[model samples]
Target: MQTFDQVIQSNIALIQKVVDFDAKNDQLLPLDFTAANTELTDEILDDTDLFSDWVNEKLAKNNASYGIGGYNEHRTIYSRSTHFDTEEEPRRLHLGIDIWGPAGTPIYNFYDATVQSFAFNDNLGDYGATIILTYDIDGFKFNALYGHLSLASLNGLEEGKFIPAATKIAELGAKEENGSWPPHLHFQLIKDMGGLKGDYPGVCKFSEREKYLANCPDPDLILKVTFS
Candidate 1:
């Protein structure tokens, strides 16, 4: 079995930012609820879309990287519904690590990779703006996907653009452009997504956890940083 530590030693700083923070941070604070059993109301979840719009509007206003949703926080802080559909379903098991921060925060390439593809997902509950990078490490070819980015990030970029390690590929988008929620980055490692382009499932059902988990290992392996 490969450890996440072994796989992600090359990029530790970026990894730690995602893993080492309480979801209730002052800047990217989680919602305040009274009881543990507090169910997310439709209004709260709807704020996600409103937030996404606000992010986009702000980006248009000031042009920044602090938008919401990514691999760092998982799904808990985002208030997204629809856990993987299956028997014995795990409620909102996160498939990616979310980088919770303000919109327009700079996002860097963890390693050398080529621009695989990108798109504006545009659905109400979608990534809004997304990009994918493909690279090979020690004969292991794999991909990294950056979801919920500013529309400007896609400007002048195309497939096969050679992105160097630590290159600023894009900025974290605001909620408006990042599927309408708080600003964050949804980072995921994919082994095989069956040739899907510009989009892939970052969340999966509990019944399929074993299979999905194997295909998608902990991204922290490449990030090489711990939250705690």
Candidate 2:
């Protein structure tokens, strides 16, 4: 018996482009949002405008089109919003890959899937407009989540909508629409949704890292974008 990830790896060639990542025209830059970065100061994180400016500056400095990364990353940037706060502990560990780019950057369906769910998580530091698609490969079923998407992406979306492979499903949302973060697409692969609809925990408490990480696999498996 093969695991869900094993099935995905075996059929990697079938996955489609989720974003337009051109090697010649687009430079993929890896961004660090963890505590160790030291570059993300209090001023930047405290203000959404400043934070957006900082992201743009970094990409411009590196001459990159997209600032990417954040899978399984234990970050401290969540401190800016109480949305992730809990009595036990803050969910500071990221469970998805974030591709920072300009708002409205197009996003495509990576597989032939049915729209499992969609919603507007309007809380501050939330995913804002989010979409989840269910896919079947080699008889194994799973879900791919596209978060921080423009509210327009949800315009005509409905449950069980069939989207062909490589279809333009959504676009990146602006700071005001993407939970007040710098423009980026939060992509995650989930083996099981645990009966949730339209949303799941993209960030987890550090203490329960193992349990959450086990359910959420590395999104790079599908993204296939190399970084510095």
TM-score of each: 0.70, 0.97
What is candidate 1's lDDT per residue for 1-228, written digit by digit as tens? 445445455434433233233344323322222224245454655677554454456545543323323332224433343322435553344566666556777878877789888998876556778998887765567788888789888998889999887677888787668876577777888877688999987776555567877777777666433334
For candidate 2, the TM-score is 0.97
Task: For each candidate in turn, give its C-alpha RMSD to the true structure in angstroms.
Answer: 6.5, 1.2
Per-residue lDDT for 73-143 in model 2, tens only?
99999999999999988899999999999999999999899999999999899999999999999898889
TM-score of 1: 0.70
- Determine the C-alpha RMSD for candidate 2 after optimal superposition of all C-alphas: 1.2
Deviation from native of the Cα of residue 128 in model 1, angstroms: 1.2
| lDDT over C-alpha atoms for residue 167 of model 1 | 73
lDDT of 1: 0.64
* Candidate 2 residue pairs that clash: none
Off by over 4 Å in 1: 1-7, 10-41, 49-91, 224-228
